[model samples]
Target chain A: MSTAPATTREILIATIADLLDGVRTVAVGASSPIPAAGAMLLRARNEQRGRERVRVIVLGSREHNFFTNGSFELFDATAQGRVDAFFLGGGQIDGQANINLVGTGDYPTSTVRWPGSFGSAYMYYLIPLVILFREEHSPRVLVDKVDFVSAPGSSEGIHRTGGPHALLTSLALFDFDKEKKRFRLRSVHRGHTAEDVRAATGFDYDAPANVPSTPEPDAETMALLRGRVTGELSECYPQFVETLVADRAA
Target chain B: MGEIVSIEALAAQIKDGMTVALGADNSGPAMAATAVLLAQRPKNLHIVCVPISGIQADMLIGAGCVGTLETSAVTLGEAGGAPRFADGIRSGAFKMMDATCPAVLAGLVAGQKGVPFMPIRGVIGSDVLKMRPDWKVIDNPFAPDDPIVVVPAIRPDVALFHAREADRFGNVRIGRQAELAAMAYAAKTTLVTVERIVETSLLADERSAAGVLPALYVGAIAEAKQGAWPIGLAGEYTTDTAEVARYAKMARSADGFAAYIKGFAQRFEAVA
Candidate 1:
């Protein structure tokens, strides 16, 4: 196994940016900077390339005032629809792509109860391009059945409208199986294999033959990501970027 | 109805056609949604719903508090309930004017700051400007070269919040997100309901005073334990699915909602 450390944020940004190839009108939830930053980078790059730039709506709190600069708030890009895509994160996720942000146990006196499902419960049904990302994939998070389904998957009739389109993780990429109604491995990150991903996930996964590895960041994309990480986003999120830079250097 | 001054009294404040803003979190003070769900206010009562997350928005909209809702996104999870608030937008009953996450925060900030507008970047060539022409993207006409958009302020008429603890004087505290800050700024009148009523001296320490909503801004303070019951608190309970379904059902109809309110009052009476 290649034991080199990987910066989950970098990989996440690169992976999501790849998916942004032709997407427009993405929705982003509040309190998640990584996905929001990734969308911003992709939109910026598209604008420079003279391509039809993507627009993003950071839900709840205004885009700029909450975390980054105020400019991130303006209504500029010019896209149709509320948002076609979204990037999400959570504390615990199940095989069918259901998420649990409420708590680990019961309602009142529980072992762990998070602030209810931030925006997960609603957004999972709306955005056309739903990409749920999680930096940590432990036995606790990757379970056979979520203790609670804070957000529903295709099986719950949520997809009848619009549900999770994708699940991105630190180890691999996954998608919900519409027919059998389960999560299946579509691809693994570079330098990682199917078995490695399964081993990390305590639950059993239906891995397809020839699961492609996530593509490496191209030179142009990497330059942009690196520059932004070393510049704008880094300034706003100094500590997080510092940790990411340290991981890259290490 | 002699004195009519209690937690149950405010139910009368809500008439048939009022626009209300409630306090909501991942948990905490979903009381507004709960109250609405149980009370089953008339459909003629249109609410301009503004929440920090979609869960509350979904609860209220799905329940029907939202005759009109202006929000960014909902659901960060994969399953259950409606996928996105998009279904409402597509159906035509609901209209969604895109607001960037940062802009929403900035709008709330502007509301809190008492500023008319704040200059921001992005959305320069985007639909947000045209769709909501009120959100102007004007050039610094004096400095024609500089490009910026001035986001207008957002101040909701009333803010209703739920907290872990509060004094009768209306001082409140939230453990996780500064949900109260945004509510205080966004709304003109702020109401707080807490799980416990303690001496005002208990909040003397600064460290235990992080998310405190000042008494000055609070119009009323009610002691409602398990106020955020079904909805999970930041470190409290998991969401109560059974209650959500119950509320969702009653929220769908006016009669059903009235019954729910009467029943909820009975339940409150049972415990009271």
Candidate 2:
């Protein structure tokens, strides 16, 4: 029997952690610290209990440098192929799975300007199991066509690497329709209706009939995340950590 | 020779073994240059790469253009297990310069500012700083009021960046987080590769262009389309994870890596 319920973050975190099977390497970019830290902490904890260990690898500007003792280099594990999964985020993600971080302009200029592509450009084409997560679910984020494709997705073909297998958000999960060049909702959160998700998205989507609720995190995982992981990251990067905590708590 | 060049022409400026600083995140020009560098295979190009999380660096190290890597993290992907510039350090093929988080940026800032060294505090206790004695802790003479650690100026020979847009004269605007500041301050010459060319005058009036790199700091600017491919633009293309894995797998071995690249090149006639 289920003992306690899980929060949205916990559910998402737990889903991610459980979904990884025999994953040796995981690359996480900026805005993905929470998931990255969760995966690592959970993996380490599991290994300590004589469980299978996942050789967790995180990639980001601050990921390695945060470990004050080692001079973390970008190419330390630069050549490992065993990395099975990647986690990414974006301001706008289209149906083709192409994401945009650059501004959306008319022809040459855009009405909205955004940061240039972070690591998504490369990760989109390189990782096998790519999960594109977004904290917000607005029509603006789930768009029909991106003004710029900061990173190409399935549109380039299988030869092109790094297409998202799943697009996770606060409301639901999405997958790419290669033939249609659009995103389709795979599932919605429990108690949340498909209409709710569609209302938030700018584009039209088709939902699966038998979609299930995302699994929730156990008490231990939540406690660990809140107590140790969040605490450490907050201490390391106060500016970044503070906002995330406030957002999650709110 | 003209100060401004096309993206194709600018690629010629880079040769192997040249010490360069590639921009971090969205501001790096290395993304567009990746294919060119891989094709040319400039011998033993030594790069003090900063914050190596994206696929651009992955392609470089995977293709063997990188010799010495000074970075913070290599992302997990197909190339996660391959012999990388940093891994080469452990294997003794390439050199590794240990860099702390703040020091990484500070060194670039010092070089960008054209200063001999910049004083920083709190890094005195981190082991990363100790290993790099070149990053020394010194008494602040000018500020006899404080204790500080000196981050050596990193002025790499060249600093390369990718801008959203540029003028014929190389005036450019970088978006948020502007991964270029330290690079701009660090390199003797900073090269920019942009998505498109816009009028320099228009930038003067644009809100986003308020804080941009003037032609004074830019050595050259190149206009290239899809220059920042694979790496997703904020509102543009979603990243291709499969391609990242392929590069990672191929980078695992010398023969495999070469074959992998050759195969990739064959697939991208436009790039080749």
Measured by DockQ, the strongest candidate is 1
Best by lDDT: 2
What is the number of residue pairs that collide in model 2?
Answer: 76
The CA lDDT of each predicted structure is 0.57, 0.59
> How would you encode candidate 1's per-residue C-alpha lDDT over B1-272 as one tens digit per residue?
11112455444454454545554444365464355444554443344334434445554554455665554344422223332243344454444444444455556668888898876544443333444566876676666465666778777766655667776556666554554567665677665666678776435778766556666676666666566655545444445556656755554454664465566645644432
User: Model 2, stretches more than 4 Å misplaced?
Assistant: A1-250, B1-4, B76-83, B140-147, B200-202, B265-272
Cα lDDT for residue A14, model 1? 76
Per-residue lDDT of candidate 2, residues A1-250 (tens digit): 2234555665666666765655666655555655666566567557655677665554433433332211222212321334567776666877667677544554123344333344444445546677877878898888877766656656321233335777788888777665676677777776687878878887776677766666566577666666665665663345556755665656
In CAPRI terms, where does candidate 1 land? incorrect
- lDDT string for model 2 (B62-139, tens) is 666776666544443322432443344344555545443445666776776777887643333333344466877666
Per-residue lDDT over A47-145 for candidate 1, one digit per residue giving the tens place of the 0 to 100 score: 778998687555433322332211222222212235677766666777777676544654323355344444454455545677888878778878877
Cα misplacement distance, residue B40 of candidate 1 (Å): 5.7
